[model samples]
Target chain A: MFNEYLTHIPFYEELTQPQKDLLAQNLAEQKLSAGQIVSSDSTSCKGFVLVMEGQLSVSMISQDGREAELFTLTKKEMCIFSASCLFLPSTFHVQITALTDSRILVIPSPIIAKLRENNIHVELFAYKTMTARFANVMAATEEILFVPVEKRLAKYLAAAQSPIKITQEELARKLGTAREVISRLLSSLRREGIIKTQRGEIRVLDAKKLELKM
Target chain B: MFNEYLTHIPFYEELTQPQKDLLAQNLAEQKLSAGQIVSSDSTSCKGFVLVMEGQLSVSMISQDGREAELFTLTKKEMCIFSASCLFLPSTFHVQITALTDSRILVIPSPIIAKLRENNIHVELFAYKTMTARFANVMAATEEILFVPVEKRLAKYLAAAQSPIKITQEELARKLGTAREVISRLLSSLRREGIIKTQRGEIRVLDAKKLELKM
Candidate 1:
């Protein structure tokens, strides 16, 4: 289990055996059922978790009473508050909810902080990982404004390598839009000869043309 | 001149003597009139510049030919690069251009790398500064998508604590929109008693209503 977690996180793989052992000793296993609030708003985060089994959705409530999905984390993924946990801050900004039945290895940030103080490699590794993650989020934000929603949907499909096979409600949650809006856009794209979609899966038929829109 | 630069940056007050000396030794002064490209696309970045006078717009062009302004740097501010600048294989993705008559201090990245290798304190200081800047950018991104454009306009106004005196073009650049679009929105807001504009200035009349919308 420990090895599998390390394999997905390249930085963790760089740690010496003893270092990994230290992390492993503090790792506590927990299971979260689908739709469970793994971490809630206004709660002080005690530690970060490594996804061993399921998916976690990072989201926040908009003033309009809608939940906006910021991002999602699958197996081997992490969250922003993972580092925030060590910083002794109160009240997290985002609420993380388990999207599916999942198992996670919870690692307290205090322990990680200790490891950082003692291990040069761990500090560098963690810093690099956080820095890269921050850059990805920033790039995503740029995409949201510069790229139109339809193109974003197209690129999301291209990256996932499949059209998300979920109900309209679920799709809206993922895309951060209304189901009617998504259905309308999908129909428009299909008419434009950019994509072909069945019940749940979507395939890009004209990548050249579709990419031009992006 | 040094005092002006230090007054603009929050960290200048805390920097060690050696760090300040290193920066002083490495800085190369540059003059750029409004609309001049400081760093163009298709060119490799040698280093970043510290703005000592006027404003510089950091932006990227999308596939569809729209320009998205990431941020603007002015007196006492520096624009290094995204983390991808170091690790990504692509050439510079954004172009830095002068928005007004400006003077800037250019410091090559090689010098920073060399200093980092020999000075542990300097390395840590650099990492901390980058991390904090990344966090601010991340917050700005979240504010954009989740918060309405008017709310965003309000936050910017509040932070600026001034009338919307910045040109509509500059406002669009900051908000990542077309100047025409920003003009239409501002007109609507003005009609609604949210703000008043004359010439180049904008005065906020209802911060509460603005916050409510956000």
Candidate 2:
């Protein structure tokens, strides 16, 4: 019955029948509410989790309470933070929150261990997925260092949906800058007729003009 | 004969004799002079490499040619940039340079793939090493975003050998800022009798006072 859920997994088909049966039975399904914390640095992961639906944001908070988004996971994406304990004995320590109501599939660490022992491809899949996250993290480093906040803001607005539903503080955290900095830039854009700012949402007024900033 | 080189690797003991023999026979030893380019994004690495002696700096250059160090490798340290192609089909693209005369051991990608096929521990080592690098890069992100240049400057001075052999321009690049920023900070430090600067190096004169800045 649960085998249906495994169908969406990239590595699921590589498993032999016994391996598949073992994993199917051990896989756990979980549902999360929007804004609920999924995982963080403190709670060591017990299983490997894959996002089945909706969105998840992965971030790290500083000792003084500043937040920085590391990456995000969408439909059919695997959250390495949950499965990081498999590759590492210690916690990977990223804070994961359900950005929207989300559904997830989890496989117990023991089951993954058994599968990895029997199949090289299964192990390779883990390595591949881990490296994929590394790519995103590295790209974020490049963006944070090389790209200016103004250009990043323009890019963010350009990529986002109309009337983006995020508070100034949240947006600031995403771009790794002070809220005041983003507020100043957003105000500048508002004056230029590039974007409209409401209480917590932003509406793009000129997408073409925004591209110039990027 | 080359089997002696494998002894320093963290995962070598986990391999069976046949696995070790296969790796040893395939191992290639190479020497590099100071300032030699070990690898770069353009050169897709031919093999997994290990630094047997001397130092290697891993850095990424901006499109405008500003350089930033990602991490460094010394004795017994594995160069993941060389082996990244195995985990990823494309180049990982970090520039590697020999900081001094160095000795490196290389095992062709085919050998690593063959070993990974048979040994989960060997494959796990790759995953572990890759994740370890991820940790450093992420810490760098955190530092670059949150730590002030003054604090970073102080910390850099605190860690290095006396008479640090780096120009202000190079130091600015290392700290992810303009050369003038580092120059201004160094001048202030010089006035405080904390350090003395030469044409290309700065000698630490007051280590205790530098700690206060950090």
Candidate 3:
């Protein structure tokens, strides 16, 4: 299972066989059922979650009593919000919930923090992962505030085109808008034949029109 | 001068006197002139810049002649963007400019990285600072994208405060809007007695109305 997990990450391709073995020894595997709460906003964040098999949704409760879906995680992706658990007052900013029966490698934050010392490659990788995550969140926030709602929806469709299909409600939560508003906009887009949705999954029919909308 | 720098940072307040002195000795002071690019987009970003004596503007330029001012740094504030420089490709995401003749302490990033290994407090401080900065930038980006231009302008004013003294160009850059649009809005606000400006200084005559506008 650990070796299979290694296949999911890009870093493994570059590592020597011995290095991979070392990482495998450091890691432990755990299985989570669908709907499992990986981390809660009130709980201490101990370590990041690497999805070996399954999916997870990152969410937060807004002041309006709405559960906003920030993003989704699937195989090969690691969740770094657990790094927050290393600091005192380890309240998680977002909650991670398993969207499917999942197998994950829960590497303790202390061990990861230890690896950061004298391990330039791991440290750099962690830095890149965290920085990219923050940048994406910031960009999404900017898109929601400055750009038109239609454009924001279009961009979301462009970026999240795989795995756990996104619904209108999910899109609304991610965009920090109301479901009714997103439903209305989706209706308008449907009329214009810009996108098509089956079940909960949305498929973009016209990337060019979406770009134009942006 | 070193003590002056240490006193300004909230995280360093808990440090013993000798610890502060030791850290201070390693920092190198540099002076920059107005309009000078202190750190470019491609240059290796080394050392955290401790603004000791003047103001600086952090900005990113788009290919379309659009410039976005991330924020201005005063004596007590530190550059959050530089966190990337310490580990990643060592290049700055934004160009930092000395808006005024400024004296700054350039504490080498490598040294800080080394210190983190031995000092848990410093590591904690670094983590908090980076996380908070990322959160602020993400929030600001969300505000800019989802909120109306008027609300964004109001937010910028609320952030800078009255008498609002920043140039229309600066305000426009910060709000991601055209200078003409900002100028027109400011003119309307001036007409409504919401704000008053003399020379380069602005005073909010009625902050209450501005909140409503926001």
Give DockQ per model, in order: 0.23, 0.27, 0.11
Query: Better model by lDDT, 1 or 3?
Result: 3
TM-score of 3: 0.54
lDDT of 3: 0.66
Q: lDDT-based ranking, best first?
A: 2, 3, 1
The pairs that clash in candidate 2 are none
TM-score of chain B of each: 0.56, 0.75, 0.62
TM-scores for every predicted model = 0.65, 0.74, 0.54
Give a tens-digit lDDT track for model 1, residues A1-214: 5655656654566667887788877877789899987775445354677788989887755446456565788987865455554432232255678899998877676777777677665555555555555555556655655666676676666666554465655665566444555777778889998878787667688777776766
> Could you list the iRMS of every candidate?
5.4, 4.2, 7.5
After TM-score superposition, the amount by which residue B153's alpha carbon in candidate 2 deviates from its true location, in angstroms, is 4.7
Candidate 2 at A211: error in angstroms?
Answer: 6.7
Q: Candidate 1 vs candidate 3: which has greater DockQ?
A: 1
Fraction of real interface contacts that model 1 preserves: 0.12
Ranking by TM-score: 2, 1, 3
Cα miss at A89, model 1 (Å)? 9.0
Tens-place lDDT per residue, model 1, B148-202, is 5566766777677756578887896687445555777788878889888888788
Per-candidate fnat, comma-separated: 0.12, 0.20, 0.05
lDDT of 1 at B49: 71
lDDT of 2 by residue, B1-214 (tens): 6666778777789889998878878888999999988776666456677888899998865566555678888888887677666675442356788999999998887888888888877777787677777766776676676677799999999999998999987897677665656877999999999999999999999999999999
